[model samples]
Target chain A: MPIHDVNVMILDNDGVLRREGKQLPGVVELYAQLEKRGISNVLLSNNSRVTSDGLVRQMKQFGVKDFCKDQAMTSAEAAASWIRHNPSADRLEDMRVFAVGEEGVFRSLQELGIALANDQWDGQQWSGLPTDVVVGFNTKMDYATTMAPAWNAIHRGSRWIHTNGDVSYRNAAGAMLPANGAQLAYLSTTGKEPAAVVGKPNREMAESALRRMNVTQDQARIAVVGDNLTEDMGLADNLRSAGWNAEGWMVLTGVTTAEDCDDPSVDRVFQDIRQITRALLSR
Target chain B: MPIHDVNVMILDNDGVLRREGKQLPGVVELYAQLEKRGISNVLLSNNSRVTSDGLVRQMKQFGVKDFCKDQAMTSAEAAASWIRHNPSADRLEDMRVFAVGEEGVFRSLQELGIALANDQWDGQQWSGLPTDVVVGFNTKMDYATTMAPAWNAIHRGSRWIHTNGDVSYRNAAGAMLPANGAQLAYLSTTGKEPAAVVGKPNREMAESALRRMNVTQDQARIAVVGDNLTEDMGLADNLRSAGWNAEGWMVLTGVTTAEDCDDPSVDRVFQDIRQITRALLSR
Candidate 1:
């Protein structure tokens, strides 16, 4: 509601950081602009399939070369961190995982010592196998590949988990194809919803990201940036739902287009991430 | 994997059925014995909640009536007939007339044809208006409430549609919970995932169910019986993995318990529906 208290700014990828594999104009000046104002910014991307290092490497190819992996938070890393702190979590190393997801998920989980027991897209391939944790950040998912592990793990008292529930994603065909959430929906046919998740809109992600920025609970003033309501804007809604003044900045870029401008939950809509950053700096 | 051919037989409700509130049993007879017959059977549960209608219902209720409404399939009347003709559709009504979900998805859609709107569980709550179509079909769902029209008709374009993604049921606390799916999820979310669905499973549901039933354009005979796959045994996985000698049977007893045993699927497993019925008949 009030703009002055907002200091630490976390940016979204795709639109805010880069478009068409190219950095948006004015990004260089904006960073210089934010630094002059003593503002600390973090780039958080929901693309969990790609590592933070990859984001930094690729954005550098687009001339926003100064981006730091340390200054970034991808959904995958955030999820891993949160799971680590979970009081009674299963050991990350020992869990039999059925990863129906992209490269980022596999690499990050591996880095965290979470073994990938299966690499099939649909959960069907993993059925009858002894899988415990079923991670869904998949991009190349089909019907059979998604539901099998979910049905098996959930029935066996294993953990039913997801990286995020971002449903449809803008495909190469420009049509939004099914994302993790859609795959999860397919698994819903198994009639088992997720037992837990570590992704956007969940309090754990917000808490961990803020803590990483060294912003204490009381000292923290957070703002979630994204495009969709059920996911991006939902992040802010979830925060507010939990009594935080978290506001959502919806860019008419990806996911929810300008056609969906009337979505009531969207606190504020912007042309793109560039505009959002410009406004924050102006404030 | 190649799809396998199998024969399936389903049972009708009201006669060989018995129920209590909304739990199903007697399905075991349908599944287990049939499994021994080298025929795989999946109970087509219309219950939208869990994977299958477990055995607790029929055993306790004494028949198949205690089925969850959302999990059961369409009767000879209601939207069942509609789906028989227009199998590939996403909406049920296109005019603003009248409707709700509790009474019946069909009657509510019929009201829409004449241009009278009403408050249905999955329908809109009309206020002041002679608007388009109205749909209704929710139990204990109030009608004649003026606000109903405004929300259903006035809010969006007229052509009202009634999808039975109804998500209302008594929870463990004995308090009503929201279910059926998109509509109820929207009702609970208020401006989240819009309410736009029709019939059961829409096209996706039909195709998947048909696949599970082991019926194809090839040499295959498939019969689907059950109280409801939507609410019961909706996740019944007797026929998945693209194909492998599968057949499906949705039982009206105890959800999908042993009732599927006699189902003509490649293999059938139920709490013992056929055995119970045969037992009852012999007795």
Candidate 2:
């Protein structure tokens, strides 16, 4: 699909618009051009710590002032959205989630009217076992306090849901640290794999974005632009497989370097989002 | 090999002799029969928290008062022993280990004259990176304090050594909890598998026992008795493959029930260690 024919755009936050908490070049112009061309755009973030409102605020810091909550979707929020639409969900309020994550997971589930089962230990066992287990990234996770109870709940038949599948991420000091996927990998050693991973490369997150934008796959031409080849570009592949006209555009501002842009998942490669903006606005 | 011809015995502590911290039936007689028959015996434990001295104390409580540190081999101790005998080791005093485990791992490595690197963060990075990273089971392991530094160290080319690979273990309350294998699984998601897993079903621990017994594989007939199939019986199979006259004897007192005992790994099955004692003593 051509950039001019893209009626909807899914932009990855970390590398596409900003890197290391600083806005990259052309983020402002990119949003301005997208709005002028009447294209619905969503900022998709795999960082499960941030809510949609938090994402909007972060985008505002990145010179994306026009980005609103409706244009933002965090993995935590996508997990919550997926839960709300689960076929087993008879009453939204009746589902209790044992969240093994930070604030975004709790807040997103709370916003969806899903009750949270207490994750704290009572010295003997969990305060309460939950019906569902929602895992996200949390640096403070301990075995006795968080993982044990979550393991017990999952073995006892809790519906396991993962916000993302990123096994490692770069920290502030450029060191690779264990992420949510590591925790998921830990729990799934002898247990079940997560029922769904509502992050990039998984269709659930993109489906949530589609639902929020009020567009069906057949009715829209989608473009996924980001720096991560497996995450952003792989998402475009998933969308195209699901009957959407989606193209993946890779940028070199974050993880992917110029030498690493030969992946078939990427439809095209750009030096930065500035090049992407120029390409989209040329016609 | 027949029971009477066995000159060396490897007993798994968990199911063969005790369950949930209490000694099982015929433990005293089992030791007495082995002593009378002049059989060399070593109590092998996968628990990484206990030192050899602690294991001796544990066995004494289980009605075997003669059990000593030399007759016990902990996975933690085996890991330390393996490190001491590593082919790359030139100066034993110069090796610094970043240990992600409980007291046994620390004490074992320290006893072997291996220096410990500080795993604590200085609000910026690890206090010091290490040449080797040894992971064991720690219910208190948190990402920011333990796993993140460990992940960074491993990615930075630290020699990764795992104490054991039991992913889940039955806690005091009989509920399964995350164990060292789960930690190993977590770290190994996008990283290299440990350079060695110094636990059951691996030849390193058995070789350590053989070294301690001062017997060559061809010079002795060995029998490994345990309740778990993969760890204990599989160890017998491993030793056999390594040219030892070894046989796996399954006892129905631990993780394996009678219904689960039809595997080809076992040369014989007993109701418990009591039956083995009776059979060996009768002939």
DockQ: which candidate is best?
2
DockQ, every prediction: 0.04, 0.72
lDDT measured at residue B95 in model 1 versus the true structure, 0 to 100: 29
Model 2, span A1-283: residue lDDT tens: 5668889989898877877767778888888889889999898999998888988888788787777889999999999888888934577766778888888999998888888776344544655567789999988888877888888878778899999998877767767788888898888975687899999989889887888789986688888889998889989999988898899989999988988888898888999988877988795
Best by TM-score: 2
Which clashing pairs does model 2 show?
Answer: none
| Model 1: residue B85 alpha-carbon error in angstroms | 5.1
Q: What is the lDDT, from 0 to 100, of the residue B95 in candidate 2?
A: 71
For model 2 chain A, where is the 10-residue window of minimal lDDT?
A119-128
A5-81 in candidate 1: lDDT tens per residue?
Answer: 66666667776656545566656765665666666677777677888888878767766656777767777776665
* Candidate 2 per-residue lDDT over residues B74-142, each given as its tens digit: 899999988888923468766778898999999999888888776345544666667788998898888
